[model samples]
Target: MIAGGERTLNVVCVKWGDKYPAYYVNRLYSGVTRYLDRPFSFHCFTDNGDDIDPRVRLHDLPVEPFESELQAAMQRKGRKGAWRKISLFRPGLGGMEGQILGFDLDVVITGRLEPLVDAAPDKVAMRHEWRYEWKGQPGGHGSVFVFDPALHRYLYNDFAADPVGSVERNKGSEQYYTSMSAFRRGQLHYLPGSMVCSFKYDAARIPPLNLMMEPRLPLDCRVMCFHGSPKMEEAVEGFEAGLLRSTRPASWLKRHWRV
Candidate 1:
């Protein structure tokens, strides 16, 4: 309970390896403090907690029995592995009950995040993959998600029962597996695209135009996601994403992406 006896909003993020430092967690916590108006608890499920802010709660990453086999399969297929995210669906995660709002470490909070917290607050919600949405493809980006652990444990249960088989059937994609799981049960809800825009796909202009113009924030964007390349740090300094996808320095990021 909060000062006014309101429910505490639990905002979560995952950090598994050395790829992202402790500052990433700090930066996200800082953003939450600035943008979220209500009482909230920020949680980080990570393997390493060194240097993370004390105010931010820390929990160990869930270790599935077949995690090694799952990674081996992903490597064999030459697919990027983000399988650990699925573990968040485990029952009673961190002994946390009720609904949780999660974000990828690579995202930048641009405005009031209350809408995201309120949108489908009781269901499993995420931004539909930007590349697949227009083509009528079914894929969840998994960058942002909201779900109650107690209600969604099946996502982890089924996967754990046959981790390797699940990987192969889903072509080693965790997002697709997660998306399809909720989708099949008619439980998947999509966050509005206007609120959760992608940096590379939505904000950056088309190829030739991108070379000439700086990437602009989409109208009504609340969370700017850097999923594939040109992470927040790289975008801030201007990353040359080859000839077709180059990005000028996004000066605006310095304002919100901080610790």
Candidate 2:
């Protein structure tokens, strides 16, 4: 529990359809509680909240007022329909105030979240998106991000103003819009590469000897992001197979799941 004058932080995750099962959400909630230090609240914004655990607060999906022609263009196979999640950008859906961290259901919490929350307030913090670099610089990935609700109203307004143009220009990438907005506003800050690293890129960087030998947890990494290729199930399998390890190793993740 947080003591007096210590601002409370809220974490949110979105579950749209059957793509992500209840168990995955449950595991994510459990993982966060086990790792995050400061007082926090975990909330799930979902279309269907049935079978969701009692511990996790559930909020209804924002409804679209009317069908617009732009909806047709936003449709894509295997992707969560864009409009369904547009409400999150709306003002006051979750009563979210202060600093908030949003994580996708696919992520795993491996260490304390204070570093992310404690990041400079002037800039919005996120991981680099690309694998390889043009120069010596790293890119920003939007999978995990920390933002101040009071300051980032533009993220929502931009989407609302030109839903079609905004989504199309950004290639329907949410993180891209986030980074671009922050960049335009001069409020973007890149988190250390190790904090929100991709399993695909970093795993390949490990020496061949290290790969063939026993898996050693990354020393500096605070959170290991399983972004594109490997899903959580495969990640769990690889960890068991010694192909993967965390900065904070857990013997039995199942046991530590409950808050």
Instruction: Score residue 74 of candidate 2 by CA lDDT.
Output: 62
Candidate 2 lowest-lDDT run of ten: 245-254
TM-score (all chains, Cα) for each model: 0.93, 0.80
Query: Ten consecutive residues with minimal summed lDDT in candidate 1?
Result: 72-81
Cα displacement (angstroms), candidate 1, residue 107, comes to 0.7
lDDT of each: 0.84, 0.65
Q: Write the per-residue lDDT of candidate 1 for residues 58-122, one digit (tens) a residue.
A: 99988778889877777784565588887778866787667788888989999888898888866
lDDT tens per residue, model 2, 1-259: 3577766777888898798888877877877887787688888899888877788889876665423734654675432323454455555668766777877776767667778777766577887676424454433576677877567788777777776677677757667767777878888888877777565565422444434443233556656666765555554344333434322223232343333
Q: Which residues of candidate 1, in runs, are more than 4 Å off?
A: 2-6
Per-residue error (Å), model 2, residue 37: 1.8
TM-score of 2: 0.80
lDDT score, candidate 2: 0.65
